[model samples]
Target: QGMVGGMKIPLVQRYEAGFRAGVAATNPNATVLVNYTGSFTDFALGKQVGQDLLLKNTDVLFAAAGVDGLGAIQAVKEAREAGKAVSVIGVDSDPSHLAPEAVLSAVVKHVDLVVYEAIREQRQGRFQGGNVSLGLKEGGMGLAPVRLDFPGKDEALRTVEALKARIISGELKVPTQPAPSGTAGANP
Candidate 1:
């Protein structure tokens, strides 16, 4: 419930905020602590922050920095070695296999799909590049299938899948916003 101010909000912050919102929507009583490393490439600092959070009894963490996140993942692994029950939520790509025991899930962004759809529209002479907004309905983002080695993996995976279905069926609405630039947030 506390904010960790940094020089700027990074993509990791967006991922963190999104996940935190999701977690809170599902579990209103959950407490979330955010830690920020001023730089995205500073793995050492990221690791230090992650370790500190672990020491504070934080069990689940989401590493959103590109390479910096790797450092956080390393810290989570070390904590696990010491018999700590810690887990990580990955970003961008499917990293469930990177540390199966520690990575619970990943917020997957289907860039390939977005690119492909744009290309298709261009080829069909329907290229309206003003803006494009994609979400669960548009199959833009989702949670990756949980790793087989993760505890309660089946249930975890099922929950995300069911949520996806609900989203697609209009039973659940995944919140989204227009890209900061006005030229990149249009829905077809």
Candidate 2:
């Protein structure tokens, strides 16, 4: 698998780091190649990077480069059309609608829930004046449905649910920073 990012910004870093952590947990022997386009809106650069990663023989690509991500998705779709067994994972909002066949799934942020919580807190006089971090435990974010059919789909979903449960229960902690290569579960 591989990941393409827009830049080395904090938001992109978080996404890349989180993805690496997940890959390490699920497939310890898997190799995760990463690249950055250095521009969030450069679709051409994203496509070039995506094609480069595909040449490395990645089965899946995670596109977390904002608008640039769409180009990565397009690359995957074109590859699929040529009989390549490749898929993409979108970030932020669902991109499955763009290319249902090439998109495997997406990472969805529950912004509505966040807004509702903030409003409810303000109404209850419990509003905090600082940043609030929420994850699976607080229903802040999650993976969208798998749009493409693949073998072991059921098993994969089951495993994902189990891992999510562990995360929510505090049994497993996901790091916000990238782990050193060859150190799967190391924090920091």
lDDT of 2 by residue, 9-41 (tens): 988888888888888778877778888899889
- Of candidate 2, the 10-residue stretch with the lowest lDDT total is 179-188
Candidate 1, which ten residues in sequence have the lowest lDDT sum?
Answer: 178-187
Alpha-carbon shift of residue 26 in model 1 (angstroms): 3.6
Write down the lDDT of every candidate, Cα atoms only: 0.66, 0.87
Q: Which residue pairs in model 1 clash with each other?
A: 131-186
Error of 1 at 127 (Å): 1.7
Q: Top model by lDDT, which number? A: 2
